[model samples]
Target: MPGMGFGIRIEGLSKRYGEGDTAVDALKDVNMTVAPGEVVGLIGPSGSGKSTLLKCLGAVIEPTAGKMTVGDEVIFDNGWKITDLRALRRDRIGFVFQAPYLIPFLDVTDNVALLPMLAGRSNGDSRKRAKELLEALDVGHRAQAQPSQLSGGEQQRVAIARALANQPPVILADEPTAPLDSERALAVVRILNDMARQFQTAIIVVTHDEKIIPTFKRIYHIRDGKTYEEAGQALH
Candidate 1:
């Protein structure tokens, strides 16, 4: 499906919390598209529906109304199209959070290999995939290290490797650079861009970090439950 040039396609996406007069419309008729190998930015002020939109896209919360196509699969249309959301999330979507959140008990290789292993891949193959991703991300040297043994940047790189282990067509990065300094933050964004192109996966980074905003070639700004698409810098 990824080879067919599918990415993430959303149309009329909306989310409402509660009902009646007290209902809060978190997202209002939002439409956005990201192509394979593209790295796009999603930015907004605090409480501007960014988190709500992310949750919907990530399948963490059900949207009141919307249509969503991930890769070539129509996961949501007014309601869910797929029955196993847990499998869908685990297999089709990858996530990178503000913190690395690597398993403390696992080594770097096992940390990444865990995702593929959970997907039913053989242990040998999973670790092989993990090593490939780690090498691509330049964290191969720390493959045997524990999570706590790595630096902040190294740990985040491992997290990213883990996210890619399943070879998902889409990656949702939620403030991935929030914990880093200016230099490290920009470096992480660069890695995301390179990896997106390398693996032909679409990436949407939701962040408020000023240091990484200008790095995006395209940006979507959310405000008042609505979205406004804005062009950012040209591809670097």
Candidate 2:
């Protein structure tokens, strides 16, 4: 019901960390298409430009050259086609970081509601939407609980709920299950799959965790700023 067929599209994405002789080419000619409701893994060793690509795709940093499209909008073309990149990020993109990073003072519900509220939705409406997402993630029972009261898995679930609060077209996850055990790691992947299917969102998880690495049906391996795609072994 929320923005179906909302996949992420990237073409010729290249990033440079500096300029002139000191510049480092973080990403080189990175091109990828993530279909709606599809989940893929981006795996690489440290310093392979994974972070750079994520920054570019998430609009946290501009790419030196590339085109980026989210859902029905073209966000970047050579330079950004849209003004207000921050607003675009808030409205069109969702991010799940390695850590849950929920606020200590705010309860789970408030944390999730914060996104919609920031985007001009009413506080009540935002909280309502947040509650719905919490229920969907099976964390509604802990809505009133503070971050400190929840387990690691529960907090991660809340983080995921927060990410989906806006129902963004694309969700970028950076080591989403890094802090969990094998059981919890697999659970997070399953949750990601369910969320992608339910919301028809494109998800890219950047991770080095071996536990969940094999679960991905498609994997992108990056080395020295270049990428090669591989079809993973069957999950069944």
**Would you list the C-alpha lDDT of every candidate in the order shown?**
0.91, 0.89
Winning model by lDDT: 1
- Top TM-score prediction, candidate number: 1
Tens digits of lDDT, candidate 2, 107-225: 99999999999999999999999999999989999999999999999999999888888889889999999999999988989999899889888999999999888888888998999
- Tens digit of lDDT per residue, candidate 1, span 48-120? 9998998899898999898999988899999999998899889989999999999999999999999999999
After aligning candidate 1 to the native by TM-score, how far in Å is the CA of 130 from where it should be?
A: 0.4
Candidate 1 lowest-lDDT run of ten = 1-10
Q: Give the Å shift of residue 7 in candidate 2.
A: 0.6
Taking all chains together, each candidate's TM-score versus the true structure is: 0.97, 0.95
